[model samples]
Target: MNVCIEDCTPRSASVFSRSNLRLESTLQELSLYDFQVDLDQVGMVLAKMFETNPTIPGVILNHDSQFIGMISRRRFLEHLSRPYGRELFLPRSIRALYKLSQVELLILPGDTLIVDAARLAIMRSPEQIYEPIIVQISETDYRLLDTQQLLIFQSFIHQLATELLQEQTQSQLMQTEKLASLGQMVAGVAHEIRNPVGCIVGNTHCLTQYYEDIMQLINAYEQELITPRPSIEELKEDIDWEFLKNDGLQMLKSIQVSSEQLKHLVNSLRTFSHMENKQRRETDIHECLDSTLIILKNRLKVGIDVIKSYGNLPKFLGYSGLLSQVFMNLLANAIDALEETANHSHNTAKIWISTHVADSCPSQLRSLIIPPKNNPEYPQNTESSEDPLTPNSQYIVIRITDNGPGIPKEIQNRIFDNFFTTKSAEKGTGLGLAISHQIIYEKHGGCLHLLSTPGIGTEFEIVLPLI
Candidate 1:
């Protein structure tokens, strides 16, 4: 049925006062109907309803006047063309039509914000389906609004949109806090893992040298035993020596390699976990880039090349460790993406990392004016300059670019969402970008965002304020 905004009545003074008052009210009147049809008759009923009234968007089905399920106009036509629909006629019961009515029944409290309901509807509805029906319930009796429901539904939808945006913003903040905590944990673990790994490497190297010397002695003994006049005593000693040398050497090498790998892992963990101390100090962006490259070098695939376009830049006051980690993750992901694309071809993969100072940087006078109690990292100082050329106005911009399959438009919106990933479980935790976003935004007072084309590639630009 066609719903119009003008016919619906506002329930309260607050209803008309809201910025998106119309959308808020629209959500209130959009209720589901408990209209049930047999499993066999669903297709016919749906087709007949829509054919009779092409404007009908959707309807809810009920069994024995009890809420059961609902169907949309678009889905009804699609169902009729399916194999299941061809086989069924006036089906004896609607029980078999469960597959046809794929719509999910959502129950919302009357007091719930209309914005939230609309978000749920948008998120859950299939690509080509009608907007979800909002079922308003009050004990046993319920009435479905027709054309009159449109205005109220529209108002509710607008309110819901505003609320959804706010929720998304809050979600981003929460994710940032979580990632900061995680980085702290990783840093601690990396610090702990590093010491033990160093010890293991040192010990293994010493043991390997000792084993090599023993092997040389065993070789000499074997040579004597194999001589024309072989001594039985020499043979016995040589036999045990050979076994000891071979096993000991192998074990030492294994330990050495394992220790090295553990060290690498620790380094990665340390980079990822460490938080930037807010105290703004002059820091070299090039050094951070170099450290990140060193850690990720081994992870890069053969034939993949990294190009650095670092400009002669002044050191800006900022957290170095956190920024290094951000670069590491972004660069690493770029390398991985290129490697993934290179898997099927012989093409060489390349990643570009660049850094420079922003020309028209804004002064941090406003930021500096705030008392130290407001920000532990950089306390307010009246001496700080308010001009663009002053140190306070200087800022750094870093860009990481990759030539891989670009992000799809559909999935790009949620790329920074927690647990959202295009990679398989083993390849990614999906937290890297999300964490990166937090680090750049919250920790460094920077911005991180993507620029891409479907087949061209993706570029992430990061902008940070220089103290």
Candidate 2:
């Protein structure tokens, strides 16, 4: 009889039943019996089988149509070469050679996942690693498989997964670069616009003074005119002098107020986009918080009560602008959460900000320094600094709290993950909290954490090491 083994097409119904057998496979759909071979007899018959396939590593040995243990080729040959080995074991029952089996045959279910089987294969010794794994299709039926083949399939899948991740990372990097360029442009425009606006404000003030002097002289001239002149009366009626003078003063005052407001907005924009290198120096946190509040004053005017309980704070060595951004994002989010909650419920929205300098960090801060291994919500530090032997470090603690609907427990762990947000796309770009976390943790070696109770409130704590 002639025999051939080639890849099977998708339409093939039974590749192994005929002499001309073929197979097709993908990583997830690998054939279980890739290394399988059958045995009809043993002794001289098994020896002839070994001579015919000397290079084949091992086999899923069967005896009289019954599944048996795995045998290593080298060990079997060594046992056979022993003195009187052929007379003692050959042609006798092959069951007597069961003691020569080197590897414990692992019988897994036919439907067992290839990944899971690969893990089992790794547990075996080096000598038995190449042995065929036996997959049991039924109580009386079994199929042999190659462990190395499964591992190769797993490697191919991982390669594809890594490529997909690289593509996503590149896209995010491009978006970040665009935002950085835009911020620089905005900062430059705000700085340039401030100069011309300041000149306009000064000229407007001078014009207002000149108008006042002319008005006083005209009033004096009218009072000095003792004879009532019809021509003077006609001139006053034609000019509507009373209304013109009053409206003119009002317009000047409006211009003054508007120019001052414009200057304030420009200053806020400049502060928010300050892109100076992150510098560690003695800087007041309170001033930064106040500047952020000015930027957000318009939003807070809508029924959000802000209460500040500031303790005597010592200036610390840290990045002032980045910390200001952190305060801004947190306060802005609090405002949004409060507004959403207020729309549904009739409760008053409240935000409380408190800060103080401390000799030692708070318990919340300590947890971040040395996170508990069991709590999956808290991130584990790559390195810890809570050691008692290290020099004592002072700390700055800032707490921001809001009375609004709190975040749910299930997803609070994901708040610091990049590109994760609960707000609409137009309202939030999903980078606020993630960027804040990076600024506090990676840039300044600080800690940021939060506590939330549903239907009650949420509080975020920022702790920074002070020098």
Using TM-score, give the best candidate's number.
Answer: 2
List model 2 lDDT by residue over 329-351, tens digit each. Answer: 99999999998977787877899
Model 2: CA > 4 A from native: 1-150, 207-247, 281-284, 294-306, 310-316, 335-342, 368-379, 386-391, 422-430
Residue 368 in model 1: shift from native, Å? Answer: 27
In the range 215-284, model 1's lDDT, one tens digit per residue, is 7886787688665444666765878955765787788898899888777667756654556565755667
> RMSD, each candidate, Å?
17.7, 8.0
Which window of 10 residues has the lowest lDDT sum in candidate 1?
Answer: 1-10
- How many clashes (backbone N, Cα, C below 3 Å) per candidate? 25, 0
Write down the TM-score of every candidate: 0.47, 0.65
